[model samples]
Target: MATSGGASCSSSVLPCAFSRHYLAVCAQDGRLRVWNTDTQSLHREFVPSAHLSATCTCIAWGPCRASKEGPQRKKRKSEAGPAPDQQPDLLALGTAAGTVLIYSTVKGDLHCILDGGHNGGVNSVQWHPEQSLLYSGSDDTHIVEWDLQTGKTRCKWKADRSAVTSLCVSPDGKLLLSAGMTIKMWDLETKEVYRKFTGHSTTVTTLCFATSRPPDSDGLYFLSGAVHDRLLSVWQVRSDGKDKNSVVSFTLTDEPQYIDLQTADSKDKAVRLAVVCKDGQLHLFEHFLNGPCKKPLSPVCSVQVSSVGAGEGATPAPVTLLAAALCPDRQSLMLAYGNYLQPIVEKTQINTSERHVCLVRDVHTTLSLSVNAAVSKVKTPIVNEQKGKVLIPGVPGHQAPIRASSGESDKRKKGAGPTEMSIEERLEQVELSTLGRKGEDKGASASLQTDSFAVLLVQGLESKDSKILNKIFQTKKEALIRNTVARLPPPAVLPLVEELSRRLQGHPFSAILTVQWLKAVLTQHTSYLSSLPDLVSQLGVLYHMIESRVKLYQRLTRLHGKLYLLMTQVASSNSSHKVSDLDREAKLVYEEESSDDEEASGDEGRPEDDSDSWEEEEDNEEEMDVTENKENHTEDEEDANKDAEESKANGDSDMDPENESEEE
Candidate 1:
């Protein structure tokens, strides 16, 4: 999909797209456009916010279309789905006018304007796949979820008393995360403020979520780089509830600039990348969320993708990843600058004579299909008495329409009324609808529409490999139970205990019952709920082989309780998208099993959530750095060993003494 190797445009608002071969741009004369680098064509342009008055700051494509339908069919077949639209279309766009607009990229036409969307300039806009929703946050210190299909505001809030600079909807569309002075997380379905993470020391400029399986994750596990002193971080989000060590962080190279992620099954396969750079050159880095940290953060090919190329250009200030479009074959990446204003505007004011504009306009003089000519034939001029000139061009007889500003709602914003209850007490309200149903479910499908559970069997691997995996999982199921019991979130542990109590009501499989109790303690507070469904299935399979239905049922019941905790955690947290992935993975396993069983009689699998703004995202990145390396190292070389000491003398949990001494 590579063109002869260069872009010719002189625009500043370049946004990177995921899964689309073309990238989009917000132009100086107030135009929104897209270019297909592979064909070197300035494909489409639209002016939804009007004139040269505002700079569009953000642009986002709808979630990968096929990804939204990933449940039943994918597990049943080994096939790729449909191709993306021929004309290409972006899902949402936000401008300096404080307007959030939705339109199809193919038509180059405006679909809807989010009326009374945000108070101040709109900074970011995003769409969730699988569901019909959209969200936007602005300089007004508010984030709102809008139903694009309805042109209605599902929910809106005035976040801290400051501007809301960045916005993100988790992969599952359950959490709406907005970062400003402090991070504020909302439960999308019921509109609840589950957490208010207070950690970033300054303004947060960029936010990205990591996937549990890598390569495919969104910004659910948000790592926000603050503009304050430039710190980058990761968070452990779940529906199980909020807890400590929630945020772990690390300082970055230059203001912890724009960051993105990608997942790789192996080196040859195209690795997914999401990047935001503070460098003029577009810096693309691989996001390896699942791999051990010692693995380097590789860059696929960082290049001078966008050049100043003469005219009003001053070496475009640090390029940021504003929007991304991935092509249909899923093999190409499209980068664009969707939301970048203040910097470009500052540079614009420098051209006192508009010499840069004249030069830029001259460069495009060859394309004679003029927008002004098109407007002249169909419209009238809107007069602005103060400027003594025309403001909006419209039909000859039609006047510039008086568009009324959204007056303050007497209803007051939801969740803003005086509250006599404590934060903890308000949390008990479980509509889990705190964030509002505005962000589309990151990706949706029939599999995730239910509440049952399923498992994923490794594909394309040898039987020996499969056996090894089964064995490792079998061992970990029991071992992990003992290891992490104390760390389980209380909400999860209590539900699991209740579930086990119900299963034992049958008065059978007492030995399995005891294992159930231990299981609850082990998985108490970890982000490892992604592993529970398989653990239970494996346990049940063992019992089935041994001819013990009672024990199998008892074991399954106990494991179910633990998973219920994870589901509930997702039901309420900023990381609900991860829960959605877990749920989708289960469907794959079950669908595979069902195919074989249906020939005889029967078979099946289940689904993923997140919570946040409670803990600063930067904090989690710190703990994550060490947690990965500590899993493998030289332990007893300094007599600081634990797990491997009996066989090789190495501690699996903490750093070695030599390293410890180095610290001293």
Candidate 2:
């Protein structure tokens, strides 16, 4: 191939690579040319169209890190399989005749022609390496996605105006960027037009995205060359954030007809700028990776060329830059020059290569490179040793979160949930089975009681009335339990409950009202409650009254539990107020109910009468050691139960749910 007038050599696409060692040029001549980028010499890669009418207008290179997804399979398996080994390095050529040809590096080899591509001229092509999608823009004003594996168009939709002219995929393959007069974004997944970027007024000539350091996680950034302003525009294509239109924009001096851009993995952050002129001139812009540059007034390197023109006003008159491929290491530059797409011109190579090192301050490097390295660095481990405050013990990764309980939890299991309930337990709440309920709990407020014995057992139970407990225990060998099933109190009772649950646990305390229950029980008051009581009952009528009263008192207990826990959690929780409220209430019961004469013979096991008999009997008697009667009046006590039963009927009218019994 040699130079003719070079006036109107209609070059379609110029594929330039600094790292690939070759300049790829696709021209209207229906031929592909490869040139050495650095030496401006010709490399061996070249391919020509099979038919005279085959004119390639666009070309894109496939990914180097080819998918392990093997050779392309057919709709039906072919007679013979291709060679098991295949390296994907080819020019995906888009032609004017609406067909695509896979041009390999080897010249004179049969090309893999993909026809039936577009209805009109295939103007541009790009490969999305990550998406495994091929984007081809055509004069049909559409971008078509080809199922490269199936050799068919996956989907096609209208894209740019005045015929789709250009396409580019991001390095990380997150976006498929295409342009004509306006930049249109197509989603990689659904191939839908996401957004149209319309900053350029004239036809867009070139498009490229900034590559992230890791070559992945590269976000939206594009460099576009436009004919309208003769300015190379740099835009940040942010899909997310306030600036969806354009986040940032930079302009170049020339009206770029053909432009190619790249960022070296140099990690220096500098970008490479290469543009082909309508006049046969090439201007190169080298950006250094040093740091942020406010503007491009001073670039790292600039190559101002006049190779095609001999004199000052010679006018290079370059038609189009079809392709420019550099070496794989970006150490060279190759150009496809002249009308015949001949003379693979090599350009002045930019010397940008620098020595790479593993960071100077790295601990591993310092440890390995030092001649006087510490013994620890080179020594082999024989046994486990604790290093300073940190312990790196070799333990097997096998242990349940719930091991054998040793701390607070152990006391609970051993103290509560025993095999059997004792005699006093008959007075307390106990469920028959955990398997399932045979009958619904209709006792009192059905909603009030849950399987709340669980709370009582949370780490064993504690109580303020140890003597009342010991005395009660003497009447029968029964279980001593904690009052954990108390309901939480409301905000009004928040201070009260906090004071009580805490005092109940903290000091010679008693139960009171609280915060959690106030919050918990808006309507479902019966959901969480105690199924058992704290004390053993000896006086039948009194025991019943006490059961009712204790149930009421424990309301504060449950409420206090919630409040205590809450106040501990919430701010300005007045727990002491609850303690005082309880003290006042306790005194009222003792003073109004007990008299000396009634205290002598005392209220003992009476019949299952109405609540007033217990209240009346409670008013008659008050003293410690009700357990003494267990032995003293075994026979008489059994007899008095009958009269109390008769009297219970007389006082049945006064029993109230709230004020019924205070013993519990």
Candidate 3:
């Protein structure tokens, strides 16, 4: 498709106009074309034959109503008895030569032209849905409200020194939004600026108003996208016009060419926005405007308008989406790229057995190649050890190995022993070699290959067999499991952790190991886990279980300490009582011994002093022995008491105050 002079183009959809859908496209080529969307065929074309240099820069459809107090209105009422059942079809066209052409859709003829309002080319034109008033913005920096009935300008004002590029009206039809260097809201009745928003640092290119209530307040909000700044700002306008708030804003990656808001159905109050960027991509987003505080608008899907070919060795042609319109049925989105119009259809399917519903792009309607699919088609060849042989792994026909020459084969047979040669011959050499090791080096390679825990974990996960995972858990050490858990991808880690926890529940030692592995993983991946809400919640439950186990262990330890202290105190008291009894017995024995010795010495009047001395010496020896015995007994008792006391003191020092109180 070719266009005239590569002028900026625009398109709009007339919903159910003339009992059928129509798409109007203006390419600034001095001509306008209307397409029947249902048939995907051109319905009508308009060209200004008098103005050979004219170009249609913009176009808008008037509201589906006739003026109540105009001559045409009087003619319609006279013919249809004061109540016309149908709406009048009006189309407004803005040209580059400073003209606004109003045409009748039913008659396909020019109705009237509104000129002399702007001294420069018109940039944008919009019609009020509730009134017959038409608004136009021109490069003359003027925003003129034209009275369609009288073909006269009701009010004109300079919006800014720059050209007024875009215009939007509130759904209530009480305010007008004009975008030039900045966005300004004008009170329709007073023709005075109510609020001026100045966040955009560059020219404001396009503007749209949300059809649903804004999330922040019960008011109408408008969205504006600007060039150079790459910002999309949503501004809220209250009913009384006392407050203007910049509710939500988004920074687009690419400069947006056009932005449109569409509602799929009346029942679904949510609005979906279609943004066309300069990079030839169409982005679809769901605007969460009516639900909660500061709800973010999220991307629904995106499609490239043009694709770069792979292996073609040619530069892809640059394609830019100038305009887009959602059909009235909401099933198809039409985009204008250069002079071509493309339709994108929405496809959906339901799985009855699984009770799942999913949406997919229609394969037949897409005109551009998918980047992923195109990339997948490219194959990188791997060079084999033999020269000039390229092996493409995973391809069925490339599995065979290139045969070696007789000399090489003889050298291999001689180097490898007879047993190795026999084994290689008996088993498929190609299969074993393709597994990354020769038959003779299998034992050495196995040990080296098992070093990476990540490789082993991925291998087990990919097997999808419960027995393999179970075997791995039984054979692999806890440290290896921890390493694997730490290294696994986020999507794979959660399921594996859950499976390990379940399998290890019956065995406390294994469960403890699993808990340790999970803790290590959580410690290493705390930031990543926070982003996945469901996985974080699951991990939290597991952590709580582990914490309860730890608390139970601590309580048991405290109980053991208290029991030990009680035993020490009881042993010390018993030892002291035994020492007291032993001392009393020793005192009684000593007294009796002394009485015997004195009686014997007085009663016996022996003539020999030597005999008396010998008897006293014997008595002294016996006393010394008894005293030594008593001292030894006392020493033994003291040692036992000392040990018990020391143990009690040690226990007291080890025990925390809180634990001691709880135990008591």
How do the predictions measure up, each by TM-score?
0.40, 0.41, 0.44
Better of 1 and 3 by lDDT: 3
lDDT for model 3, please: 0.58
The sequence of per-residue lDDT tens digits that candidate 2 reaches over residues 1-664 is 0010011112332433322444565432334656555466555534343333456676566655443364434412566523322233566777778888776664534346666768888877777666546778888888888776777878878775578777876565666777877887667777777666777776776776644443222344556666645555555444352333443334444455455555555445556655555544455565544333355432233333222332244333222233343333455555544332344344435543332111111111211212575557566756654443422111111111322235435554566444233545433433433334566344421212322432222212223344532332122111111112232221112222222333332222122222222233223333212111111111122223234446657787999899888878654346655666664435324444346534645545545667657666564443333644565578688778877887778874456666656633
lDDT of 1 by residue, 29-83 (tens): 3456566555546667665532234556666666544433555455447455334
Candidate 3 residue lDDT tens string, 1-664: 0010011122231111111245565422234667665566666766643233456666666665644556565675466333332333677878768888997766888889998899887878878767778899999999999998899998999998889987877655777888888888888899898888877777776777765343225456667777664556777666555444467766555777666665322224556566666655666665655423364454466655333422235333333444555444455565554323232322222222332222222222244323454346667887675566432122111112222236745664676453233434534543564666534566433322343455466566665577666556664465555555565555455556556555444467666555555666667666655544233224533543455457668988999999999999999999998888764444223233566654544425534456447657567657766876787799999999998889888883467889989999
The worst-scoring run of ten residues by lDDT in candidate 2 lies at: 1-10
Who is ahead in TM-score, 2 or 3?
Answer: 3
lDDT of 2 at 430: 36
How well does candidate 2 match the true structure in TM-score terms?
A: 0.41
User: In model 2, how large is the Cα lDDT of residue 192?
Assistant: 79
Better of 1 and 2 by TM-score: 2
Pick the winner on TM-score between candidates 1 and 3.
3
